[model samples]
Target: MNTRIGTIFAQEFRLARRNLWVGLATGILGLFAVVLGVFGAGQGAALDADALTLTAASLATLSVYLIPLIALLMSYDSFAGEIERGALALTLASPVRRWEIFVGKFAAQSLAVGVAILLAFGAAGAFLALSFGTGSEGIAAWMRLMATAFVLGSVFVGFGLMLSAMAGRTATAAASAVGLWLVLVVIYDLALLGSVMAASDGIFASQVFPWLVVANPADAFRLFNLALIETAPVAGIDGLASTLPFPPTVALAVLGLWLSAVLALGIRRTKRIVP
Candidate 1:
């Protein structure tokens, strides 16, 4: 809210926009959206009605991973990269508070990623409507998908900021962020599958497994989105046919706690670097 913070926020936005990678990533995602939309349209004619619904549901499900990947890419360099280059110290030496710096940087990164997602979804939705003449239900489903994607993106951005704040170098931060994504979005599920396979039939189906799955941010995102879009049955997730009661509210609370804690740690870390 202070002028100093506003200045830092503006600087962050400028840096993000000027970054070529940001531009490239945005363009690529936008293109992907258009292509997916076109595919959705083409499949409408040949596919049975129920099958088309499934396809849309699947695409919505896939967005859980898609949005987070994009957010991770945007935030991979939020803080550590500057520190690595020896610029972070000079930046911190300014009159602005460390929290201000973190908030500004987070906002800028979030805005950039949000824009990319909006563009992608808008293009995709428009194409689907124009090509297939999808009706009100289709539009409503897409809206739910968009809402879920936003939640998913916010979770990742918070996570990426935390990783960036803790890392010592740009490469380490980037690699760690990507590795975390791999584990959460993909490997974690595979590991769970293996565990279930090994156990076959037991209490594992109902008790600890459900709790363990919620602990995973990716799983939470998947469950929340799947629930929102009414596609949980399609995912064939046994036992967890839908997200638990109040899962969306819980997800938002958990994500906010993570973000606030990380930002606090980051500011503390920054303060120590100088004081």
Candidate 2:
């Protein structure tokens, strides 16, 4: 099983690398890292240790959202594109089980995006080490940031694969993935914010907002990084501790749920394809 899955995953990764968006995202992430490092170095004198730690943590948190967007783009056409090109049927004619094909392909897609993020964070870590002269802690923090980014990315890529398996064409899959991403990562938060605003005087606003934030995978990733390694809680969420039970743990669990749900759906949907 391992050998079969590894073969398919290797092939899928090569195919994914040919996609223009994958390369473009990698380049953009590298550029962003360099630019962020330069900005941090330039502001070296103005900010102290605590402020620097906070800023780095905040930037790492932001990557939770940015990385997932790219991951979705990477896998949004995994199955649909092949079907559109009339190649999916031939590929399925092989001896591999559909579930293996689906899981292996999604794994490869997730790894490809993970590689991009790893490169970006590595560059950022080197920069911090050079500028701050405290490479130990900065490098450690970035390493955790990379792991968190990779896990968050897996959730998005799995969802994209599921969308691709369900859609009739690559275009439809792409549209649906983008729409879902926007809703989950942005609109959902905005809606929660609106609800909180409307109930400003109520207990729900003060008590339930943290739980609502956990529903957004991006926020969950941020909370995980901020609360755990950074030990710097999110700003302006003082009521969170009293309401949300184990915010970091819950966030991790929610992300795990998304990954499992999407991957399971993708595998089931792909198995049903006639090809």
Candidate 3:
């Protein structure tokens, strides 16, 4: 890109590297992926499927719970922490546009997390490919898993940045990040299920439940990847995937929309940061 943004991106990436906790958390996730890939059959013979498919399934389950949380942890303090310490004032004094700083930091945080995911999935993929054969279909599925998983994570990176921009305090931003994760990944789905059960045969279950699942990036990510493998079912979630209101590609599109919308809000807030 242009020299200005490029410089900002490089600087931001360097700054992002200074945080080792992000690397450690994601490394632990990658370790889990490898463990799940290599030994998933121990869980049950029924689950003894293609290593890649099993890897994807196990990871889909794990990531919906972990990726968003980790993404939020990586980004929760991007602005608020700096601002809390009066560092943002010095940053604002610099010649760079506020939007550029926010965009650059966002890109850098995303890249840092993305690379960890790439490595995590890559290790599992290598094992799955070697054990299951390097057929195009299997390879394609693995690639799709990585892409979808990363998109799912990026949605929360945006979430974290938005919280940081709006909260203006590191503690508030951190707490909001965790709260948002619980709402989207856990409480939202549980509440939706409860509503469907409570309103069984009502228009809410018939007309709204399916759309509501797609509305949460977490659920959309879960269904899309489960559908991708056509798993031969994680606690019956494959059935949910089968019943997706929209195509799997549309879930990916929804994820893209979430990331874009949240990042836009973060950038707008950045421009208004007093210091």
Which model scores highest in TM-score? Answer: 3
lDDT of 1 at 248: 56
Give per-model TM-scores. 0.82, 0.87, 0.91
Candidate 1 regions with alpha-carbon error over 4 angstroms: 42-56, 230-275
Best by lDDT: 3
Span of ten consecutive residues with least summed lDDT in model 1? 47-56
Q: State the TM-score for model 1.
A: 0.82
Ranked by lDDT, the better of candidates 1 and 3 is 3
Q: Write the per-residue lDDT of candidate 1 for residues 128-241, one digit (tens) a residue.
A: 677567666667666666665666676687678778877767899899998998998888877887787688676885666766666666666555545554532354442363
Q: Give lDDT tens digits, candidate 2, residues 1-21.
A: 488789989888887777655
Tens digits of per-residue lDDT for model 3, 1-275 = 65656777787677767767556766887788878776864543475456677677778878889888888988899889989999888878878787787787777778877877888788768866776544565567678778887888777887898889889999899889989988998899888777777884767754677778888899888877877776536663336677666678877878888988987888998888886
Number of backbone collisions per candidate, in order?
Answer: 0, 0, 0
The TM-score, computed over Cα atoms with residue i paired to residue i, of candidate 2 is 0.87
Q: Using lDDT, rank the candidates from best to worst.
A: 3, 2, 1
What is the descending TM-score order? 3, 2, 1
